[model samples]
Target chain A: MSRRPPVGVLAMAGVAIGVLGLPLVGLLQRTPWSSLGATLGEAATLEALRVSAVVSLAAAAVSVMLGLPLAWVLARLPFRGRALVRAVVLLPMVLPPVVGGIALFFALGRRGLIGRALQNGFGVDTLIGTTAGAVIAAAFVAMPFFVITAEAGLRQLDPRLESAAATLGAGRWTVLRRITLPLLAPSLAAGATLSWARALGEFGATITFAGNHPGRTRTLPLAIAQANEAGQPEAAIAMSVLLIAVSLVVLVGLRHRWLAPRRRWPEPSQEIPSP
Target chain B: MSIHAEIQATVGGFAIRAAFDAPAGTCTAVVGPNGAGKTTLIHALAGLVALERGKIVLAGQVVDDPARRRRVPPERRPIALHSQHNLLFPHLSVADNVAFGPRCSGLAARAARRRAEEWLEKVGLAEAAGLRPAQLSGGQAQRAGLARAAACQPEVLLLDESLAALDAETRTDVRHLLADLSATRVLITHDPVEARLLADQLLVMETGEIVQAGAPEEVAANPRTPWTAGLLGVNLLSGRAAGTEVALDCGLALTTATPMTGPVLVAFSPAAVTLSTAEPHTSARNTWEAEVGRVQPEGDRVKVFLGPPAPCRVWVTPQAVGELGLEAGSRCWASLKATELTVRQA
Candidate 1:
C-alpha cells in the first residue's frame, strides 16, 4: 500500500522497460515517414494486407471456437492424463515458429503422412501451400495462447455459480450459455485478440508451411520479409511500424477496458470479499 | 408435497447411508454435527450425487432407484437448495438472477421478471432487485438467494445451512423470515434452536446415519446420543431401566414417570434441577448429594457445575446463589421431580 519503490525493483523495472521499448523506438526512428502512404497503397503491400487480415481473423475465430470447450474441459473436469493433455496443448506456444511450421508441413503437406492418405483414399488435396494452409499454420502457433488464457480465466471462476444455476432448473447447456460464458466473456475476448495479434505477425510458420505467394498465402509479415530481402528497406520499416501500431492499439485498448476491474462503486464490502 | 428418500453413497473413504420420510406439507429439520453427511444427503435428494443403492420417492413419484438404474439429473429434479453464501450470478442484476429459473422453464421474459419482482417483495428486497449482488449487504444478498430459489415454486425446498453464515442479529432476522415460509421444506442445520423454531419434525444424524427422528420436543426431551445431548444442552445419563426406575452408570438411580425396560437413556434439562444446601426432605422422586465444582454467572442466573454422580449442571438465579453463598467446594443436594426425567429405550 505504500508508494515507496525499492532501488533494486526500480532498476529491474528500468531494464524491463528498456527491453520492451527499445526495439519499437529503433523501428520508428528508421521508418520512411513521407513515403509511408504510397508504400502502403502499393499493389503487393495491399494484397499482403488483405490476406493477413483474412488469415489472422480466420485463425482467431478457429482459436476461440475450438479453445473455449477445450479450456472448459481443462479447467473444470477431472480426468486421468489431464496434465499430459494440457502439456501437449501448450507445446506449440513454446515451440519455435519455424519448427512448428515444419511439423505442420509434414503432417499436412502433399505426399506427407496423412496428406498422402487423404490424396489416395478420399481424393482430397493437401492443405499445404494454400491460404487455408496459412490459416492453419497461424492457428497452430496461436491456439495455445488462447487456450491457456481462457483456461486460467475459467479456473478463477466460482464453480458454485454453475451449481446454483443447475439447482434453479437450468440444465447443463443453459447454465453454460447463461452463466459460464457471460462470466468468461472478457477473458475470451482478450485471448482471441492476443491470438489474432500473434497470427498477424506470424512469419516463419506461414512461409514454411503455406509457401508465401503474391496473391494467395503472402501475408503482411511475409511481404515485409520479401521487401527486406529485395533491398527495399524503407518499405519493410514502414510495415514494421504499422504492425507495432496495430499491436499496441489492440493490446492496450482491450487491457484498459475488459481486463481492469471497474471502480465505480465506493463500497468495498460488496464484492463478496472473496470468501 | 412429501419427500421419501433412501440415499446411499460413498465419497472418498467416507460412507453415508440415510433414509427419511417427510409428510405432506411438513417442515423437517435435519440437525447434525459437521461431517455428519447433512450436505451429502441434501445433494443426493437434489440429484446432484448418485446413489449406490436406494430409492427416492417424491410426491409418490420415483425420482431415484439404484436397482432400476434410473437417475435424474439435478436440473430435472423438482427441488431447490438455498445456501447462506447466496452464490448469486455476479454478471447479472439481482432481478435477473431471481428470474433465471423461470426463464429457464420457458416463461416469457416479462412474466419471469414479474415473478422475480413478486418474490423479491416477499423477501423484502424489492428495492435492491435492480442492483447487482455485490451491491447488497450480506443479509440482503441472502434474501435474494432465497427469492431466486423460491421463484420457481419447486415441490420441495432444501435449505443447506442458509442462515448459518450471518452474524447473530442478521441470523435472527433471516430465521424469522424462514419461519414465515409455508413450503414443504427440509432444513439442514447444526443449531438446535433454529431446528426447534422452524421444523415440525426433527431428524438427527450422527456419522452419516439418522441416529434419532421424532417430533422436535420429543427428540429434545429424549436425546439418546451424546452429540444430541450436547447440542440440546441437557444432562444425559445412560443406564439400565426396570419399570419406572433407572439404575444409572454413575452409581445413582433416577425415577421417571414413564415406564421403560432394559437399556435406557435418561434426559433432563439443567433448569429442572434445584440446588439445596441442606438435605431435602421434600416429596421429590430423586435427590443427589453433590459438591459445587464451579459457580459461574450466566446473565441473570448462575450455572453451577457439580461433581459427578453423573456430570450434572444446574442453573439457579443469582439471588438464590448469593442467598446460599454457593461456590466451589460448597456441598449441596440436587433434587428433581420424577416427571422431569425423560426415559427412552435405547
Candidate 2:
C-alpha cells in the first residue's frame, strides 16, 4: 500500500477511465433537465418504453426456457463435438450484430427458406418487420450470455450433491427442480439480468430485421436513433440517460457477483456462522 | 434386509473385484488403505456406479445383474449412501434436506417434514431443523445427512467414511447413533476402533480386492496383509512354519504356539513386544537385536518400529521409552513370548 505505481501505468489507467467515463459525462451534461419529465412522459416515448420492456423481458424468458437445457448438456455430458456445439451457441455473441441480423433475415425473412413455408402453410406472412422479429434479433445476441453464465454455475456445483440426492431417492426431474435449480438461483438471476440488459440496448439487429415502426417494433434504442436523425437531440439525450440509469442499476445490483473476487467452493471443514 | 453383492467394476483403469454379505440388521465395516476401492464398492451397492460384470441383491431382490442385463438406477434402488462430506444441500433448511428423500419417495410435503423431524429428533438434531445446512456445525450437518438417508427407510444404507471428518467426541456420538439404526449397513472406514465398535463383520480390502472378511475380532486377531495389520496396530509377518518354529520371510525364525508344515502368517500385537536397552535372559523365546526405524506416540504409549532382521512394532510406555533411551536410529532388543504370536495358514 505504501509503494507508488509507475507514472506510465497511472497515466494509461486514467486514459482508460476517461474513455469509459467521458461519454456518460457528456450525456449528463447535454440532458435537457427542464424538459426531461415532459420528454419522457410523451406518448411516443412511453410506447417505445413499453415495446422495449416487452422485447427485453421476452428475450430473457426465451433465454431461460431454452438455455437451461443447453447449459446442462454442455456442462454434464461427455460426447464428441461438444466444444464445437458450444462454440456455435456462443457465435452470436462475438459476431457483428448486423451480420447476425443478416443471417436471421435469410432464414426468417419474407420468401426466405422456412419463412416462405411459414407463410404458405399457415397464412402467416413474414416475421420480418414484426415485434416477434425484434425479439428474435435481440435473443440471438443475448441468449449466449445466459447460457455461458448458467453453464459456469452448473460446472462450479459439486456433482456429489446430485449423487447424494439420487441415492436419497430423488428422480432426475425432482433433483433438477428441488436441488439443481434452487442452487442455481443466483446464477440464473445474473444471467437473466444480463440478457435483458443486452436486449434492451439492441440496435443493429432490431433495426435491420424488425425495422423502425413507432409503437410496434420501435424500442427505446430505435426511438433514440430516430430522434437523433429527426433533429430532436434533447429527446435522444433523455432516452440515453434513461438507458444509462437502467444499466447502472443493473451493474450495482450485480456488483457482488461480477466485480468481487472469485468465490471458492465450500470445503467440508469450513463452518459457516449461524445466523 | 440383507445385502449380497458380487461387484466387478473398472474405473479409471483401476479394477475392483470384491464380494461380501451383510445379514439383516447387521453392520459390516470395510477397512482399507487409500485407493483400496472401498468407496467404489459402496458406490456399486448404492447403484451410483455401474458394475461391469457382477450381481447385487438387496433384500432378496436383484438390483443389478449384468449377465441378465438388468440394472436399477440409483434413484430406484432401495439403498441410500451417506458420503464422507455429508453433502447436505446448502440452499435447503436442515429439515428440508432430511425430508428430501421422503418427498422423493412420494410422501406429501407435510408428512415428509414430519418424518424428517422424527429422524432429526432421533439423531438429536431436532432443534436445528429450521437452520440451513451451511449454518450448522460439521457434526450437526453430518447428522442431518444421516437422517436424510435413513428417513427414506431404505433397506440398505451405505456409509462412506461418514464419520471420518468429525472430532473425537462427535465421532463417538455419531457412532452410537449409527449402531442404533436398524438398516443393514455397509460402512467404509479407516479407523480400527470404529470398525470394532460398530461393525458385526469386518472386511479388509487392498488393491481393489477384499483380502479378508470375518468377524471383527477374528480379522483383527489374525490380519492377512500388512495394511490390515497396520490398521489394527499389530505386526504381520509371513513365514513357513514347521512344528513350533517358523522361518520368517524377512530371514528370522520365531517360536509360536500354533504350528503348521506350510506357508503361514504370524500376527502379534505391539503391546506383546517388550523393548530393552540390553539383551535380556527371559522366558520369551523370540528376541532379536534391531535398530529403531521410527518412533510414534499413540495416546500414552510410544510405538517403536524395529528394523530388520525381524521388523515389528513394539508399544512401550513413555516411561519405558525414557528408561530404555529409545529413539529413531537407536539399537534395542525386542522380545516377544511364544504365546503372544497368532499363526494362521497363509
DockQ of each: 0.47, 0.52
C-alpha positional error of residue B43 in candidate 1 after TM-score superposition, expressed in Å:
0.8
Model 1, B156: alpha-carbon shift in Å?
A: 0.9
Best of the candidates, DockQ: 2
lDDT of candidate 1 over B136-196, digit per residue (tens): 8776787789889889888888888877656666577667767777668998988888888
DockQ score for model 2: 0.52
Q: Can you give the lDDT of residue B305 in candidate 2?
A: 88
lDDT of 1 by residue, A1-275 (tens): 77788899999999999999998888888888999999988988889889999999999999999988899899989999999999999998888899988988788788687888878888878787778899999999998889998999999889888988988899978988999899988788889998998899998999999888887899989999999999999989888788888887887888654557565344533333211
Listed per model, the TM-scores of chain A against the true chain A are 0.91, 0.92
lDDT (Cα, 0-100) at A265 in candidate 2? 40
DockQ of 1: 0.47
Model 1: lDDT of residue B224: 74
- Score each candidate by Cα lDDT: 0.86, 0.89
Model 2 clash tally? 0
After aligning candidate 2 to the native by TM-score, how far in Å is the CA of B60 from where it should be? 1.4
